[model samples]
Structures are given as C-alpha cells and as structure tokens.
Target: MESSSPPADTNRASTAEGLRFAFGTLTVLPVRVARWDRAAARTGMVCAPLVGLVVGLVAAAVGAVLLWCGASPLLAAVAAVAVPAVLTRGLHLDGLADVADGLGSGRPAEEALRVMKQSDIGPFGVITLVFTLLGQVAAVAALYGQGWAWGAVGAVASAVVARGALTLASREGVPAARPEGLGAAVAETVPFGAALGVAGCCVAVPAAGSAAVAGSAGQVVGAAAGAVLGLCAAEVLLRRCVRRFGGVTGDVFGAVAEVAACGTLVVLAVL
Candidate 1:
C-alpha cells in the first residue's frame, strides 16, 4: 500500500520558480514558469513585488536618463509611464480598461464578464484608460519637476505598492469569479497574515528609504500616507469587483494593481 503523504518533491517550494512565475505571468520578461500549481501560485504572489521592484527601477532609470539628457519633466514623465506599459505589454492597462467596461456596463455579473472577455473595448474602457494614463503621466511629471531623485522614488514606490496589492488580492478567502483562468489558479494561495506582512514591507521599506534620502520626517510620513492611501484605494476596488462579479478575476487583479499605482502616484504628487 502507498503511504499517505505522497512524495517530498511533489510540493517542494522553490524561490527561483516563484520568481520565474511572478515575472513570467506579470511581465513580458522571458522567464519561463515551469510550474502552474497552487504551490507556484502561492510563491509567485508573495514574490510579485520583486517583479514590481525591477519594473520600477527600469522605469526610474529611463526617466532619470531622460532628465539628465535635458528632456522636459513632462517628456521624462511620459517615458517613465510608458516603460512599464511596454514591459508588461500593457497587460495591467488592458485589464483596467476591461474592468471599467465590465463595471460600467451596468449589466448583471454574467453579462458584464462576457463584455470583459470581448476583443473590442467599449466607450467606458476608452475613457477610463485615457484619464488613468493622463493622471499617471501628470503625477510623474509633477514629481520629476521637484527633482530626479524624487521622481525615481515615486516611480519605484508606486510600482511596488501596485504589485503588493495583487498579493493582498490573492490571499486566503478571496474566491475566484470563475472555475478557470489565473484568478482561480492563484486564488486563496496565500495566507492573509503573510499577505499583510508583504504589504507592510512594501510600504515601509520604500517609505523609509525615500524619507532618508529626502532628509525629512515629513517625507516619511508623506510616503507612508501615500502608500496607505494607494492600498486603500485598491482594497475598495477589490471589494467592489468581488461584490459585483461574485468573486475576483484576473482582470480584477489587473484593475486593482493599476488603481493602486495611480493612487500612489497622485498622492505622492500632492504631498
């Protein structure tokens, strides 16, 4: 008779696989995800912020180089905003647009989800994408106008928080809207406390470093406040999507990330 516990290697957790899964699914990065099981999803969600960190750094580097090359803050900001889109192949933006159309359709859950899966974007999607992109560019420009360092900080901080929001969305008890797809694969893969721990680190680490560089306690407070507000905005959207759709979907995750990034950028620009 076979033993009850199965093989030791069956569910073995690998950080490398986790990173690959995170980068592979989240970005246009070439990393191959070797596993598609719950174990992989669990590790991937927890490591999502690492993908954000790299994306943010790339975005910041582009903006900073542009600024150094005598580009206007607006132009640099546009580059900064565009880099992540290019890197992720605009996956999150499309999700945001789709989500907007779905929610804006005012139909029942099934109909709305069907609308979301369609190839063509509706008027609601177009309008939402326009304003959201504009908000991001404008906010990045504002931060850049202050200085390159501040602008870099804003780009990096917002990206990390945005992806961290995904981890929260994937935590235990968050059901998937459908029986298949990414939402279902990664649904409830993370422990709630673990998600919170990751989120706290995402907020605290960047805020602390940014404040130190700025040489002000106020900057620390501002950074924390901005991150907190961003996460709060994402949380609101997540709940709304869950309630409206009956659970979370991959599109919902994308929408949540974009909203979190936008919120963080706007708040950082203001404060």
Candidate 2:
C-alpha cells in the first residue's frame, strides 16, 4: 500500500510555505518587500505588536542575564540592544535611512519616496543614521548607569510600546504612495487588539514590579509617562506622514519605531 504521508518534496514545500506565511504575517519583513496581500498585510500589522513583545522579552531576558552575570550596566544595555538588532537584521535601521534620505532631499513627496525606494544612501541618510544610533547608545548607557534594572525595563518597554505606536499609526493613516504595498495592506488589515496588547505588555512590566524595591512609585510613574509620550509622538508623526506622503510607508513606520523608542527612554530618564 502507498504511504499515506506526504512525499518528502511535498512536506518540504509545505514547511516552506508555512514559514513564509508566518514571516509575512508576524513582522515588518513583508512591509519591506511588499509581499503581503490585503488580508495578509492586515494580519501582519496586528501581529507586529506581538512580535515586539517577544522581542522585548528577549531583550529584557538578555539584559537581566548579563546583569546577573556581573556585567557592567553599560554592557548589559548594549547586549539588550544587540538582541533585537540582530533578530531584525537591522531592517528598521534601513527604513530609518530611507526616511532620512527622502526627508533631507527637499524634493516633493513623490520624488522623495522614489528616492527612498532605491538602494542608495545619501548624506542625510548617513548623518541621520549616525545621530540616531548614537542617541540610543548614550541614552541606554546613561539609564543603565543610574539603574540597570530600570534601564532594562525601559529598553524592553520601549521596544514593545514602539510597536504599539506603529500599529496605531497604520490603522489611522492613509494608503501607500503607490497602488499597493505593505502600507496599504497594513492600513486595511491591522487589528486594533494588536496595538492594545503591545501597550498592555509595556504597562504590565512596571505594574508587575510594583512589589519589588526597584518598583517604586517613581518607577511606575516613569514607565507610564514614557509610554504616554511615546504614543503621542507616534500619533503626531503618523498624522504628518498621512498628510505629506498621502499615507504611511515602511520607512515612516521605521521612523515611528525609532522616535517612539527614543521618546519613551527620555521620559523614563526624566521621571
């Protein structure tokens, strides 16, 4: 009798298809390449926050482990940053560059976006990338020096909360510049719950810590303030992009994540 199981080639193809679907549905990778259909894109948009949660936890766990291993606060912070950077293979950074290049060109929105879609890097892109990276490094370093655990919390919280901001932006924004792309799919399909879940996770981190010495009222305030500010900033950016570019692009989303993360860290530091 013939085996009921699928042939090896068929099984491999099935596995590959599943992997592709997961990647396209769970993160910004589909946004980058513009592979998602309307429904898939929406599903991906909703999954973005959950992706951030996973990323945040990974970052936090790494930072916590480094701290436990007697690593300096700075080193631990760096390790935390490194985890997500590696996981996403700097895709967000690329988006940042594209946005910077487009914004700096001083061209019309359509032309700027055209430039952004190309693989070339302009002077503005280079400078913006440097400044953004430096700012993040310094901010992380400063927070770590003052309080490693709090710093870890800020890092993780920022990562997750930023995704929430992104989701909100996608939901409220216009369509893509072109007829179709990740932006369009995201706008059409991203669920509201994904953003809520991301925000919840960020809030829960500090709330859960309310029992520990490190989880004082001040820390709670700081986390809450950071999240609020991040969300607000993201909304402003989203509105501006919708008006200027006619919709949110993958680059805009990247910019939103970076801005939100930075804003959250600043609030945490101030608080």
Best by TM-score: 1
- lDDT for each of the candidates? 0.88, 0.65
User: Any runs in candidate 2 off by more than 4 Å, and if so which?
Assistant: 1-36, 191-213
For model 2, how does the per-residue alpha-carbon lDDT over 7-115 read when each residue is reduced to its tens digit? 1121112323333443554344553333334444444555456667677778878887887788887788778777767767776777778877887887877887798
RMSD to truth, every model: 4.7, 9.1
Question: Weakest 10 consecutive residues, lDDT, candidate 2?
Answer: 1-10
State the lDDT at 184 in candidate 1: 79
TM-score, prediction 2:
0.78
lDDT measured at residue 38 in model 2 versus the true structure, 0 to 100: 46
User: Estimated TM-score per prediction?
Assistant: 0.95, 0.78
